[model samples]
Target: MPRAKRKRASSENSTEPAAKAGDKEVEKTVTSGAITPKNKSAQKTGEPEEYAHWLLKSEPESRMDKGIDMKFGIEDLKSQPNQTACWDGVRNYQARNFMRKMKTGQKAFFYHSNCKEPGVAGVVEIVKEAYTDHTQFDPKNPHYDSSSSRDNPRWFMVDVQFVRMLNRFIPLAELKQIHLKHKASGGPLKNMALFTRARLSVQPLTQEEFDFIVSLEDVKA
Candidate 1:
């Protein structure tokens, strides 16, 4: 069983839980990476989703038992034959649209949520831009949507290749503390989508914010 985690009120600066982490509820979404993401290379890719840095969530142990946080986590990406895989199974329109903005060679943080420890675990590169999520067309698939069609793809996905893990794991607890420390001055994470949209499977991150978080790992190292 997953351990019960401690909770803290969101930063005093914000009230809505649209982004960020740390709440009483176990933030749940169909963002689990247990299922395989459909790879539709033949499908048409989309224009940019209008964002820069991103953080994508997955359950490291979704596809197997007693996972070592590799199958769909940073380890999986790092260990893939070429350290690349398609990101799929996203049903939310906002998240899908986020993927649409991704471009080849961009980077995103591969976060592991709804697990023993939740936080930014590693980095991944966008190997391929957004493409139609074919999982929606399979009637037998859990992600199948009855309203979607080939003419209009309601969902999109991206291909990501592993980059490297942080020097240390930056747990959500530390992030919450950092949020409080900077709440008065509006720091890099002041408006980070992760804190406001805690449940959002995909959220944008500012380069500064990314650097700040990555820096923490370096500091810890």
Candidate 2:
């Protein structure tokens, strides 16, 4: 399992509930952001549906995890068997819950984090929805949680299939400028989870924000 950078303020290994760990603010923000209009429509119609969009982060630089290299980028995902891999090792309760909300066939931006020029590099589709994360049960796994059990797993993961790289790599620096600009003018990305919850490895994106960001690929910075 790839080891995600501990950009989170709390210890990644902590299994306490988000409320107990003083994460109510983050949980509240993520909960609101994760609620896509599509989901509401599905609920109103009594039909199954997927989230509008999401963003997943992984470190591109080498980081050892129990003697295994933990570096995983968009290209690494593209080379996997069937160009798919389990998005495991997420320990944050807020992030884990977001994964659980994902439905198959949903799309997500593959963002490079903890690396030089970190930014959204590509897209991926959720091939499999939430399931128990096996790494949490393995003693040798860096993400192992002795508190979790097979019967009542504490972590979950989804399987994502590579879609395609963005036409242009959107750098984080450029995104920050856009975020700041939009925040002042009531633009689409003003409340984007990517900027509001910078430390979260997995974040939700409203349909408008997703589309707006994708449109940037063709625009000159």
Question: Which candidate gets the maximum lDDT versus the true structure?
Answer: 2
C-alpha lDDT of all candidate models, in order = 0.63, 0.73
Q: Indicate the worst ten consecutive residues by lDDT in candidate 2.
A: 7-16
- Residue 85 displacement in candidate 2 (angstroms): 0.4
TM-score of each: 0.72, 0.80
List ranges where model 1 is wrong by over 4 Å: 1-50, 63-71
Q: Which runs of model 2 end up more than 4 angstroms from their true locations? A: 1-50
Taking the tens digit of each residue's C-alpha lDDT, what string does model 2 give over 1-221? 33232212112111111223225664554442344555664367432244468998886767676776667888888777788888887877778777888888889999887666778898999888888888889897677789889998877888888999999999888988988999999898888777676667777787888899899999998
Q: Write the per-residue lDDT of candidate 1 for residues 1-221, one digit (tens) a residue.
A: 11111111111111222333222233243232211225232122321224467888865654332221223567756665676777766666556656777778888888876566678898988888888777679785555678889998777788888888888898877887788777778787776777766657777776888889888987763
Among all candidates shown, the one with the greatest TM-score: 2
Displacement of residue 1 (Cα, Å) in model 1 is: 35
RMSD of each: 11.5, 6.4
State residue 200's C-alpha deviation in candidate 1, in Å: 0.8
Q: How many backbone clashes does candidate 2 have?
A: 0
